[model samples]
Target: MPEFDLIVIGGGVSGITAAAYARRAGRNVVLLEAGDRLGGCCHTWHPVADFWLELGAHTAYNSYGALLALNPDTAFGNLIPRAKVGYHFLKAGKPQSPFGRVGFLEAALTLPFGLGKDKAGLDVETWFTRLLGRGNWQRLLAPAFAAVLSQAAGPYPAEWLFKRKQRIKAAPRKFTHAGGLQGWLTELATGLDVRLGQPVQTLSMADEGVRIVLAEGELSAREVVIAAPLDVAAGLLEHIVPELACRLRATVMAEIETHAVVVPAGKVKLPPVAGLIGGDDAYFSAVSRDYLAHPDWRGFAFHFKPGLLDGDARRRKMAAVLGCEPADFAYETAKTNRLPALTPASVALARELRSALADTPVRLVGNYLNGLSLGDAAVYAAQGG
Candidate 1:
C-alpha cells in the first residue's frame, strides 16, 4: 500500500489540476486515472490524422486566468478570432439564412416568448433582452449560448443567463491551443506522482486518515480530495461522507451531448467561418476547420440544445443537419460523453456540496462544479482555494 498526503480521483481536468496544486503546495500527492490515457473527456484521439482531434472542448477563452497561469506562455498559441456567425434554417426544403447571428438574437427578444426589448424599468433579463434585442437572441446569442452550454434556452432561469453574460463578457471570442489542451494537461502533470490506469472504486475514513480502494489495490492518504464527477464521487464517498454524498446526489448536472466527425480537410466543404449552426433545432450543428491550430482537418460537430438531453431524440434531430444517416453519426466516438450543464438549481447544489466539504479538506472541482469552461477549471485549481 502506498501512502500519500492527498489523492485525486479522476484524471479529467479538475483532478489533474487539483493534483498539480497539491504538488505545488509541496504535499505528497498521488493522481489516479481509470482509463489507460489521461485527459479524460479532453482526450483527443485522431487516428487518421496526425494531430490531436479535439473530441471535447475546442477553445479556452482568454478570461481563463488559471489555465493561462498554468502555462505562462499561453499554451493556446495564436487565437483565431470569431469571424462570422450565422444560422441555417430549412425553408422550402432548402437551407436558408433566416437570420444573421446578431440579427436572429435581436429578433428573438422582440417575440412574445422572448426577452422583450423594453429597457425602461427593466430587470437584468429585460435589460439584456433590450441590449441584445430579439434578433440577436434568436440568431447569435441564443445559438452561441446553446453551443457553449449544449442545451436550449428557457430551461435555465433568466438570472443564470445574466450571470453568464457578466462572467464571460470580457472573454476572447474563442482560442485553441497550438498543440491542443491535452499537451498542456500533460505538461501540468510533470514532476507530480500520477498513477495512470488506476480508478478509485471505494473509500473509507479513520482517525489516522482516509483509506482509498483503487482497482489495483488499497492506499491511505492523510487527506482526500475528490475531483471527479459529482455522481462518481458520490458513490466513492457514500460511506466516507454520507452527508456530502446525499447532497451531491440531489444536484442536477446538465447533460450536453456532442458528436465529432473528423474528415480530411480537403474533403470537407466549409463556409467562411469555423463554427456554423444549421436550423432552429434548438442546437448548433456545423463543421469546425483549423481545429488544432492548423488550417487542415475539419471536424463536424453536433451539439444538443440547452435542456435537450434526449440522447435518442438529439441524435435523430442531428441527422437532418448533418445530411447523414443518424446511425452513422451516433455518439460512439470516444464513447458517449455528456457535457455538464449548470442551471441555477444545479449551481446552488454545487455551492452546497462545496460548503459541506470545505472544512474536511475534500476539494471538488470540474466543469459541472465551476463554470462551463476548461480554462475556468484550471484557474480555479491554480488559485488553490
Candidate 2:
C-alpha cells in the first residue's frame, strides 16, 4: 500500500480544507506547502498595534457553509449595511461619491437594467452592458468587477454572473474575523500533517500510486489532490498528466498587486463607505480599509492592474487616488497571480479537462477548477472535486 491514502499539495484554504475532510473520513493524509506558512491568499499583516490589515481575502458571507464548518468557533463581524453605504470615485483627481448629483442622474438612468433577469449565452461584459446599460457598465460595473475579480473583465460567461447575483442576494450578512482569516486558517490546519517549505519538484503516476518528488525527498500516495494554482499545477503535472497540464496551461492567469497603507485617521477624510471604484483606465477600481474594527487608524488597501510597477510609480498613483502626498502614507505591498480569466472558451476548456480527470486518482481543487471565493473552494474541496 502507498504511504498515505492521499497527499494534498498546496496549503491554501482549499488544500487545508481537503486535508481536514479527508482526515475526518479516516484517510491518512499529508498536506505540503511551498511557503513557510499556510493561508495562501488569505494573508493578514499587522503594521501597527490593534490594526490587522488583510493583504488577501478579507471578508466572507454568512452563506459560506464550508468555511464555517471547518472552524465552528470563529466569531464573525458584520459589514456596514447596503442602504447606508457609500463609496468614493476618483473624478479629476478628486474623490467624489457616486451618489452625488451628476453621478445620481447617471445611476438613475442605468442602474435599473442591472436588476433585470439574466439572459443565456451572453458574455459578462455584454450581459452587464445590456442589463445595466452602457453608462452603468462603464462607470460602475467595470471598475467594481475589476476590484472584485482582481483583473480586467473579459468575455466571462454570463452564467457565472447569474450565479454570483444569486449568491450576493442570498448573502445579506458579510462577516470577517477579529484576527482576520489567518486565525480561522490556523484553526483548520490544526492536527493535519502539514509540511511547509517542501515544494514538490515533479509528479508522476506509476502502477503503485501517484509519485510526488519534493526537494527533500520523494513521497507516494494512493491519491493526489492538486490544490495549487493552475500554472504551478501545470508545471508539476507536465510529466505525469501531460494532457491535463496542457489544458491548465491554456487558461489565462492574472497577477494582482495589493498595497496596504496606514494613515492618521484625522488626516484622511473618507466618506462613510466600504470602497471606491476608479473611472476610465485607472490603475485601481477600489481603495478602502477596515473601518468597522479600527476607527482610530485609517488602513487603506488598493488592488492594482496586472503586471508590475516600480515603487515610485505605485506611490504616485496611490497618492493621486487618496488625495495625499506620497510621503505621508506608510504602506506595504504584496503580489499574487492565481486569478484566472474565466472567458467562455477558458470555462469550456476547464469543464472538458475536469471531465477528463474524473476517472483518474488525481483530483484538482482550487479557484481555477471551482469558483473564486473562499466558500466556493472550500465546498468544492470537501466534495473532492
Candidate 3:
C-alpha cells in the first residue's frame, strides 16, 4: 500500500475541508502547507487593537452551507444588523449617495428589465449597463463591484455577477467570528493531520500512484488533491500533466492588498455609514468593519484596486480615506493573489479543464473551480469538484 491514501497540498480553507472530508470517508490523509500557518488567506491577528483584526478572509454568509456543515458546533462571532447598513460613494473627497439623481432615475427606468435573459456571451460591464443604464453602471455598480472583487469589473463575464447576486440574495446576513475567521479555521484544523511549512517541490505520476517530492523526502499516495492557487498548481503539474498545466497557465489572476487600520475614537469622525464605495479611478471602493459589533471601536478595513497601489502609496491612500496622517492610525496589510479574472474565455477554459480532470485521481479544488467566495471554495473542496 502507498504511504497514505491521499495527500492534499495547500492548507487554506479549501485544503483543510478537503482533508476533513477525505478523513471522514475513511481515507488516511495528510495535508501539507508551505506556510507556517494553516489558513492561507483566512488569517486573523491582533496587532494593537482589543478586537481581532482580519488580515485575510473575514466574513461568511449564511449561504455557506458547506462550511457550516463541516463545523457544526462552531460559534460565529456577531452579525451586523441589516437595518444598520450604510453605503456611500466618495467623490471630490466627500461622501455621496451611491446613485446620483440621474443614476437613480436611470436605475428606476431600466431595472424593470432585469439582468436580461441572455448571459451566454455578455461581459459584466455590458450586462450591468443594460440592466441599470449607463449612468447607474458607471456611478454605482462599477466602483462597488471593483472594490468588492479587488479587480476591475469590465473583463469578467456577466454570469459571474449573476451568480453573485443569487448568493447575496440567498444569504443576506454576513457573520464573522469573535476571534476573526482564524478562530473558525483553527477549529477546523483540529484532529486533522496537517503539516505546516512542508512545501512540496514537485509532483509526478508513479506506477503505484502519485508521487509527491518534498524538500525533505518523497511520498506516494493513491490519490492527490491540489488545493493551491492556480499559478502554483500550474507550476507543479507542468511536466507531469502538461495539458492541465497549460489550462491553469491560461488562467489570469489579480492581486489585492487588504489594509486594516484602527483610528482613535473621536479622532476622525467618519460618516455614520458602515462603508464607502469609490469611483473607477479611486484607490479603494469600500471601507468598513464591525463597528456595530464593537460600538466603541474605530477600526476600518479597506480593499484596494489590484496592482495599482504599493507600500507607500497604499499608506497614503489609507490616510486619505481615514482623513488622517498615515502615522496616526495603527494598521496592518496582507497581500494575496486569490482573485481570478473570470472572463468569458477563462470561464470556458476552467469548465474544459474540469472535464479533462474528471476521470483522474488528481483533482483541483479552490475558488477558481467553483466561485470566488469562501463559501464557494468550501463547497467545491468538500464536494471534491
Return the top candidate by TM-score.
3
lDDT string for model 1 (141-181, tens) is: 65555555555543444443423322333334555544455
- Predicted structure with the largest lDDT when compared to the true one: 3
Ranking by lDDT: 3, 2, 1
Local lDDT at 338 for model 1 = 61
Cα lDDT, model 3, residue 92:
72
* CA RMSD of each candidate after superposition: 5.8, 3.7, 3.1
Candidate 1 residue-wise lDDT at 304: 48
For candidate 3, the clash count comes to 0
The C-alpha local distance difference test score for the whole of candidate 1 amounts to 0.59
- Compared with the true structure, what per-residue lDDT tens digits does model 3 show for residues 139-202? 6777777766667887777776636423333333666655567777767768888898889899
lDDT of 1 at 299: 54
CA shift of 229, model 1, Å: 1.2
Q: Provide the overall lDDT of each model, using Cα atoms, as 2-decimal numbers.
A: 0.59, 0.72, 0.72
lDDT of 2 by residue, 1-385 (tens): 6899999999999999999999989999999999998999888777886877777776676666776666644342222322334466766755666644244565567667666765455677887776656767776767667766777774666666425422433333665566667666866789999999989888888677798889878999999998998788888778766886887787878777676777766656554456666555445545455345356776667676755566678777777666677777865655553577777665565677678777778888887665677887888898876
Candidate 1: residue 133 lDDT (0-100): 72
TM of each candidate vs. truth: 0.74, 0.86, 0.88
